[model samples]
Target: MAAYEIKFRDARELAEALKALGADMRSLPFFDNRREIRSVYITDVDVRAANVIKQEMLSRGGDAAVHAHAVDCGVTESDVILFGTVKQISFLADKLETMPWWGFPDTVKVLREALASFSKKPATIDLPSGSSLAFGGRTLLMSIINLSDDSFHSESRTYGNVDVAVARAVEHAKDGADILDLGAESTRPGAARISESEEIGRIMPVIREIRKILPLMPISVDTTREKVAKTALEAGADIINDISGLTFEPGIARAVADHNAMLVIMHMRGTPETMGSMCIYSNLLKEINDFFDEKIRTAISSGVDRAKIILDPGVGFAKDYSQNLFLLRHLESFRIHSKPILIGASRKGSVGKATDSPDTAGRLEGTLAVSALCAWAGVDIIRVHDTKENKKAVMMAEAIRNADYA
Candidate 1:
């Protein structure tokens, strides 16, 4: 399966593949109909204002439900579950401010923030290195420079050689990679964890060499240990891409906070060695979104700047193929958190499963397909091995996505 088969070239070809997969978009009338009606659960709402809130929601094609027996018993507090579109919720937040009951004398602060998270999401992130990348404009590519010999994708592996890694870094930078990610520790399922000293030994030279050549290149060190993160940042790496989300090393967040470097908090269930067997989620997307909220708050509490944070939903990390597809399809939905999103699906097992391809070498086109979708969905960063090919695909998709703008 070293040779990747070309299954689809154009929309017709893609449609044919979808047809074979038991999906016919032409017959599916709901393709372009996007209605996002979110349910907001407001706990311990003053029961006195329940009627007013219920009336206000119903006026805007929404509804707020309280305990069915609350009105009769005159309960002082009731859980309010309001269902409405993002626009309707924003308006309702404002409406509640003037109701003279739940409305405060000064401003409706809590409701404003709750609704704002969904309505006015952010489109860009500022890094500590005085650079910023705006999402919803173009797709940013991060080329993979794996210093580990046992990474899932053999092509991405540099065989633990700094020279080969540096050469690949130069090519990635030359091919318009917006960032270069150097990973010394392999996060592939069941891969053994390396010592912090060994990991630094493997990557510090490559990081320094890349910085010497591309001084302004954004370099991210992928690790789950604090000492590795500290030494890597001090050695010139710009971002700490922690797959554990600060659960592995308790002090890693502090290390990133102390250096004021950028953070990539990926949502993985367990260590690489344990994650494969831990591929279970009661509600995949909800659990991930909730995890992101908790982790982001934890990072902020640890003193890491919120503006420097990026999110990767951890594709293929403790996720099955169908779950990975769901995450990819809803990448745009994460915009509600107002942070940059980076998805690294390059040559992963899910892509191989999608295209009936085998191994990392056979998933190039499948990976390209994901790059196009991420670009179209306004994902901030795409980490890939084939930087040049992905750059072209993302650039074209971005151009089309922004073609109507003046």
Candidate 2:
């Protein structure tokens, strides 16, 4: 007899494994409910709520981990980490809905929303051009086209020549890039902010030329200024990738809404000039989640449709080397927002640190490693410098990820 182990990512995969064992189709759902376990973190939860949650989960054949001081009320609030199968958690949420004290009912609502969001990924993202960006089946690649003279990757800088920028865009398109991101200003450490006119001068010509060349290819402008986003969208850009997460220039969200364009809200702590000094976090993942929650609310309040928004964890912006690594590993946690997650870990300092490659040019292998991991983690869009190579990595990783489906 052979005794070993099997692994599955979600209920569908679990069902497939059971079906291969000749299990009854109707019983698959029943097995699916109890086969997989999940963990969810909720911070600053009221101690009263924590106790009730613990009791309910235990009563349902699951458990929760609370602060050491939670049981005796030594702490006013406690951080709760819940552990349970899908069936147990769903049953717990249903029971919590009947309790009217300490916002248990509201907690249940949030829990249900999160559970639903994480389980079901968005299949397609509608774009402004009456087209859609498909997801779920495979990973998408966004090629970076830098128009700054002082870009970290010196070889990629095309500040003065529009022809060079256009050529790079064409090459990226031919290299299987699903989206092209053009950034005029450098956001590297200690990089000075350029005037609006200078920024526009660098990218406007390139945007117009790219629009003329690849009329159907989606163009994204990486900027934090309202006027720049408005100009780019008017001149043929379809998405705005804001590193500041709409905090730097809230008006940029309005520009996106008015143009009916997509927005990529990235989480960052400070400006490029000061972000290096702001790499402090008590709880990295929770802080980022809170940041996304607020920025998402801000974008929606400014009239941007929820479907047109994407979330990026800002891998290199304000994160230190270790934090960047941790962020990449837990990209799936961001799925709770129910937005397509975009990762741009291409040749960043973290990649250099990981591979012991001090030079940007030598970090291709590390970048490809990160790309494969992101693809397996179900990242929707991977912004990369080497489009063709990373496309291959993403495709191969995706094949392995869905190998069970075959």
Score every model by TM-score.
0.78, 0.97
In candidate 1, position 223 carries an lDDT of 91
lDDT for each residue of candidate 1 in 270-372, tens digit (9 for 90 to 100): 7788888777887676688778889999999999988888899999899888888999987755665778889999989889888999877889999999999
Model 1 segments beyond 4 Å from truth?
Answer: 1-55, 62-86, 96-136
Scored by CA lDDT, what does every candidate get? 0.79, 0.89
Error of 2 at 346 (Å): 0.6
The count of backbone overlaps in candidate 1 is 0
Error of 2 at 107 (Å): 1.8
Model 2 CA deviation exceeding 4 Å by range: none
